[model samples]
Target chain A: MTEKAESPAARTSFFYLAIILVTLILSVIALSLGVTALQGGDASAGSYALVGFIGLALSAYMLLQTQRRPSRVTFEMPQVITTILCQKCGFKNIRDFQRGDYVFKEAEPCPKCNEKMMIASIYREVKEKEKERLS
Target chain B: MMLFVAFIFYGQRIQMYIMIREVESRLARLKFIRDEGRKMAISTIKEIGKPQEDPTERVDRFLEYIAIAPESMDPAGVVWKLEHVLDVRDIRFKDEVRLMAPEADEAQLNNLENTLEAALALNIIYKVIRHFYLLGKKTLSLYIIMQLQMVLPLIMREAEAFASALKAFATGQPIGDGAGALVAAKLMHGHEKRRIAQDIVVATVPLEGRTAHVLKSEGPGGNVGKPGDGIRRIIEETEGKIAAIVMVDAALKLEGEKPGDVAEGVGVAIGGPGIDQFKIEESVLKYKIPVNAVIVKEDIGDAVSPMRKEIFDAADTVIQRIKRLILERTKAGDSVIIAGIGNTIGIGQ
Candidate 1:
């Protein structure tokens, strides 16, 4: 089986994480700047503190959203559909095949013909084209 | 600084909202597909109950079934399996027809079988699609949803191809995939048609100084008859006289590869669960016969859905390649088996 490609969610999450980290780093820089300005008795120290606080809050919210988001999803092989056709009346019915159904095996009775519907054919649905288009 | 921070946060929130909306829309699409699948299934059951419906109605119902079917069922497998059941049914039907009208000829018997098989193949194709489509909906997992989204188009294409193939069979028209057989027919004059296996036919085409045993899954209808069995039988009957085996098939091209591109390789190029490929490999190895593969590249969409103009055009290229390989690889008077490997849905020899 082909490996599942990385999901868009995963790629976007990486970018989100990078933004969060950058914001956190900026907050740390602002915190030091505020501390130094306050020691120097600068009035802008309060503004620096406010900027740092807002940066912290923004990063925290981004982090929370990232944690709450769903990760990339994967899947196993698809299922097969089998059809049983009533030879007597030519009536046909289909369903997800069970473990026991085989080609030519006698299956449930035809609702119309009253004769047993033989497992006329079993086929796997082709889904490759849609996937190709998606990729 | 405060205003800048507020602006950035506002932008982030809007971006997040848009992303969520996209995901929600995707989920909604999945739900829609699932519902469609269920409706198709219901429709199929209804169609089956009415066996006296016209061919166009039957075809429409079958297409509906395929549109909603899940992606797991192999279309080729369904057609191949139906060929078996239809073979038995065809025999019985033929017997009945002959008994009723002793004037029924071989051509009439064949026509009857072809019609039945085509109808069955179309029906099976739709059911298979509905099965997968509904299954995907039921799962409701993002992974499965994405997978279904990808495969649904392919299933639709295959359905269309089968529909066309079925139409041709009903009307007695030649289909496009029979290119390999066409090549064989051109090369070999006075070739006799014989069923090597159920729905698989072979003819002896004499090449320039060599005999080419050409085989294809019987068609002008939907059928990918068991070529593995046919090849095996030819190998056994020839008693090791076969010098080389050439398998020609329509292979799925990777993204960026040109459709109808011709390529050569060694080993069995047959696709699927590898059952047939394994059988061919075993026979070739046991007989010590060299195996050569010639493939006409096509996208997954083109390979199964229908024979596109480009794919049909590739046939001439493939034929030239096969002839060249036969001349270069084997000597005159050496018996070679050339098998056209693919669903012979529409093409006929």
Candidate 2:
């Protein structure tokens, strides 16, 4: 089954948009109250205005920054099973499995020969080769 | 002040996260050990039991037998009889377990033949006397020879003891008094326990329409009816004294997990109705008997042939637990029930 991947930054941007929009409306309400209270005393009105400005600024910054960074980062062709063959003992190993599979994410030594293979590099080489052939 | 408070909360969150991570890792390791244990147990059971000989090798054995027995005689049949029947098979039987005495003169042999005839006439024939000619100062002593009279029963007794011990260890039950009657009582305790669970009566439902041949056909427990019914019968036969029946079956290990992993789960309803265990448990609850189950897990392939060491070791654990529980629950005359639930294939029920 295929799934459309959503980036973490995209997911965060939506979250911040909702927060900033609510914060902006709350600041407008605070400003209206401050103006109405200015008739009684200017000191309380000035403090309210300062607080509203800080709230709006913080919300805007949070919204923009969340959109800037990616929400999720995933490698290309994650579905492929990559195996690194060792020259010395002729060992073949599956380095990575599909999601919803076993959690063998740590570095593993070949049980038979105690030889280690860098699965990430093997995947990288395969990707490079595929790219070269495509070009 | 706000920053300090936030830092404190953050630290607390970090601690919680670390604790959860530790727990998850430990749970993973425990699961792995259980799975690996199951695999080893199965391999060991198969290894200890006699290995099946190849068919061609069996045929060669048959040929050897034919060479000794000739056309008319059956080796086991003839060899099981008088030691000196003057048949070609005696030469082959010599290599086997039954051996003729070197000292028997013609007169003693004649007397033995007469006695054998008399033993057969009185319906007091035994396999040992038929195979070997007994010769001694008195025929009475020879009749009670240890090999002929005691060894077979001893082997059977040992097998039963091993099975009983396995059950007791697996279930955490105490081995009862060493008295023969008590042993029999303990064995019956398991049967009686299964009887108390009311769901056992359901086993009789399927037998209402099925023929005897159909019921006796080769299948689970040599019964052709639905397995749920069989479980029900097991419960019924013991009378509503059993609380819950826990069938311990070996499940196969996943490729990732090491072999002999002990996987424990409420198995799906086998031989029909979704969870027959629930039915049995419900029946027990209806009768106010609290029901619970413990499955000594192994892989499916190795369930029948769990290794002797693993079985014995696990059985030890089972027996200890059972003994503690029974001692706690039982009084002087209280009937405690325990069952050695397994597919009694090679186990020699």
Candidate 3:
């Protein structure tokens, strides 16, 4: 019988739980200190306890937000394009490239001239603006 | 006094807990990445094992494999292995091209093979780096992620340049990186042009009172002709009479530097596997030659992608700088070699 490995999310959730526990304990200690300071008539000590309590509460809120959020990673893949031009009619067409396609190879016959269409260029679309600006 | 001490203790405890949670989150992210990398490696190996029925299909299969393959092996050993794989792929591509077009001449076939190899190599290197980069990101390795991020723009630019280079080779169009060759062609116009070696061209251009040997990679194919070989041969041919050797090439600009900025320096300015730079250095040392380097600066994003308008415009400035260096460093009636070092894809002579 093999034991299953814990996912990163699950592991992170456990850490978050631990953080919440610690924060709760700290908050309780701060509130109890504030109550004892008030009973002893020491306002300055009570204020310090209030500060500690607020700090822990803020920390707890941040930890809870992080725990509730999902981690996402995003990336973009660049596009590769092939351009074909007709030698006789000067007609041009752009299409996605197939593997093993080299430059200057003859493609299907030109529709207008009935002449061979050649792979004039095989280039990647590097610029995003070119797509919007040219089209 | 009691309440004050308790408050301080709780405050410290809360801070410690926060730090602990942060570290735990980072470690978890790293583990996630390691798991993802392992999965990708397994998938890639399985893809490589699939059988192809035809030569073209085999080429496609190999090309696709290289394009998506993850870099799971040790970094130190991967470079040599990648080079060998690229070499084998080049030979296979050449053989396939020959079979497809039996009528193509030796020169044409050689050009095609060189262009294809450079393009494929560029693509494979980019993919491999990206694979590791993704792994780093997944693993939540801040150091690895940061380092890869800094160089990612440069790598992407190189990939785009190589792609354009392939198009230039296919269509016989001049590309931007061929600024060196273009400058050489302009200076040596109407002069006796000679082919010193494979993919290297040389011609004599007369300056104000001296003669300079204008050397560049053979263009307008996807070629970064052997500038080191061209320089060494010219030095030998002139019997060490060469007064100075000036190299011009595109360089990656620092974050604050403007694109197309020209800077001058000493020694070889060529970039790559350091093979060509090493050759140039050896020859220069042997003859005790004064070497000058002129670099046109561009952002990493612009350097390897298709030549931008600014980079193209900077060529005039680069030419001026090269001429200025030669005039300043060497005297009249002396012989010099001006070598333009880069992939001469589109920009023509």
Q: Highest TM-score among the candidates is held by which one?
A: 3
lDDT against true structure, model 1: 0.60
Candidate 2 residues B235-343, lDDT tens each?
Answer: 4645655433333323343434422233333332122223344454545555554432333433322232213233323443544444444444444333333333332
Q: Write the per-residue lDDT of candidate 1 for residues B260-324, one digit (tens) a residue.
A: 67899998877754657867887888889999988887664454333444555666687788888
Please give, as one word, the docking class of candidate 1. incorrect
Model 1: how far is B182 from its true place, Å? 5.5
In candidate 2, stretches whose alpha carbon ends up further than 4 angstroms from where it belongs are: A1-135, B1-275, B304-308, B329-332
Task: For candidate 3, write residues B44-91 as lDDT tens digits.
Answer: 222322223323443344345342222646676554555456456556
- For candidate 3 chain B, the 10 contiguous residues with the lowest summed lDDT are B40-49
Candidate 3 lDDT tens digits, A102-129? 4445789998888998765544443433
Candidate 2 lDDT over A1-135, as tens digits, reads 022234322334355478678878877777777887787776789866766787678777866765565433221222223344454476767644322111112235767677763332111111222333421
TM-score of 3: 0.53
* Rank by TM-score (best first): 3, 1, 2
In angstroms, how far off is B152's CA in candidate 2?
48
Report how far off residue B242 is in candidate 1 (Å). Answer: 0.8
DockQ winner:
3
